[model samples]
Target: MNATVLKFGGSSFRHTEDYHRVAGHIADRLATGEGKIVAVVSAMSGITDNLKEVMLNVNKKASPSNVDAALATGEMISACCLEAAISRLRIPVMSLNGYSLGIRTNSDFGRASIESVDPKQIMAALLEHDVIVAAGAQAIDQSGRLTFLGRNSSDLTAIVIASMLGEHACEIYSDVPGVYTADPYLVPGAQLIPELAYQTILQMSLHGAKVLHHRGVHYAEKHRVSIICKSLTSDGAITGTIVSGHGNARSVTVARDSPVFSCASLEECDSLCALLARHDINVLRLEDSHGVRVCIVSDIDFAQRLVSLADIGPVFIGLSNVVTELDSSGLLVHLVGDYDGAISLVRQIHEQMYPAVVSVPFGASV
Candidate 1:
């Protein structure tokens, strides 16, 4: 049997009108014989943020368990709303919470991993129902404790479900039309890439691209699942980025001429690592020559957190001068297609920027 999993982001479920739009989209797809379109939905926009605020107010040092409990409510509410929307259409649907099903996970709380998912009941229900609205980002532990997947957890939910069902495709519906060379809002004249190899998307996601979550992309790559990212506003017709298993072997070349800030002290290193880990920041490299130099590509919030941690006297010292060189405008150029083309591009960049190549860490080759 053919199946495609559909996942909608928080922004797509912001209001009742948005729910109607989702229902309409599903109905249209159902009419076209789109077999077993499992729907994975995120919380309404800003609900998770509000929940975090409440958690912070209750306890300044909220543990991961407390945070998971607070955040899981967002997805619960979203699932309920979506169930109602689907029901209004007289469609047979099953709204499931992670607890209701035997989706066991570890006790990591905020970043829990799924230990096992008993899909027998879910599969049976899907066969009889028109839609299955599963709460995204949440799972129950073996001890019956609620756990949450980290940020953008909805994408991970869709991927896991698709993998379990052996679905051919997983469609991620979001506000953006598709994956682009750079964030269109930040970079003018950025072009949307029609097709991307799985490794290319993985690299882009790892390097701060917000179109797809890293865990979700990794899962899809592992399972050889095709992923299509499209805008919810586009009626699902305007094709977005198609990520598949096979593509021409390619290499990406990136060059930057920015001053590298060096940090010293074991305490500083530990503190930075902890802060970045908490924020799910990805660090590319950390080298120690005369001093400690760490390179990372992440969101602005992560950078701010690092700066804040550095301000304290315990972990870091004598590194204030290096902080002034921080630039948010660092350009990242990625070339993904043919391997020969990638090599040519890297050669061209190396020639243009004749600085000693200090570090070159190989990323996904697609």
Candidate 2:
């Protein structure tokens, strides 16, 4: 079964005309006799924020699970609305929630990872409908409990879906034209980059580039899936950024650039590492300063769970863009990322805040 997954960001449905345009584009793709299409979409623009606001207002002491349940409604609404719009155009389409489509996640309420995906249900659904509109970022656990990914993780939803579909490439449609040499908002005259290596794109995301998140890129790279990042409002030719994956290197020994979580003590660090080790999680010490403990890990789920542990103090999360320090209360105490005239967190790909473009050739050197 030949199929492709198309993901639309929240910006694509910000306005009324945008919904029509996106639906029309999907219709156009189907008109040409392409195979089945699965379109993944985020919540409508401003809807997620509005929903979050509602959650904050309804109950300040709400649990993370409750908050996730509330926030997920935004994507659900977007998917249903888009499905309606497409169906009105005389196209066969149906909206399906992640849980109904056989997406299962871990118990993490607000930031869950896909544990398993049964694509049989999705394939059968697609066979009945020309397009399957999936509500991204929210899935169910094994016990039939609702869980969510993270903020702005619709990209994760898309890539995971593509991986399950066994597709080579999935298209991510957003408002940004494409990946640029530098952040256009930060550096004036920055131009587009047509292609990028998967490793480079992962670095860009880990470093603070908002165009794509590292989790999605990491999953795609692991599954040998390519991602095409393009604009939702483009016309004529399809000029976008292509992130290509590479096979396992038999001879190339690459440095480990995973982000680390630092604590204030040794006993705490050792115990934390020991506990994580049982789960097949490895922690690598990267730096030492004044008896400080710094260990690198793959993801932040460990840090999130360590919030209540009294052993660690002031857990610092190092991201590509910012270093977030979580207080003992698990709240964001302070954020430090890219600073002007100063060196930010260093990564294997880019050492400075102003990222050096080594992934693709200069498409537009303005």
Least accurate stretch of 10 residues (summed lDDT) in model 2?
Answer: 247-256
> How much lDDT does candidate 2 score?
0.68
What's the CA error at residue 7 for candidate 1, in Å?
A: 0.3
Predictions in order: lDDT: 0.68, 0.68
Q: For candidate 1, lDDT tens digit of each residue in 247-364?
A: 3212222322212334566666666666667656654334445465444444332344355546533322221110111012343444233434544544544433434433332221
Quote the lDDT for 317 in model 1: 23
Clashes of 1: 0
Number of clashes recorded per candidate = 0, 5
Q: What is the lDDT of residue 362 in candidate 2?
A: 34
Per-residue lDDT for 364 in model 2?
38
Model 1 poorest ten-residue lDDT run: 318-327
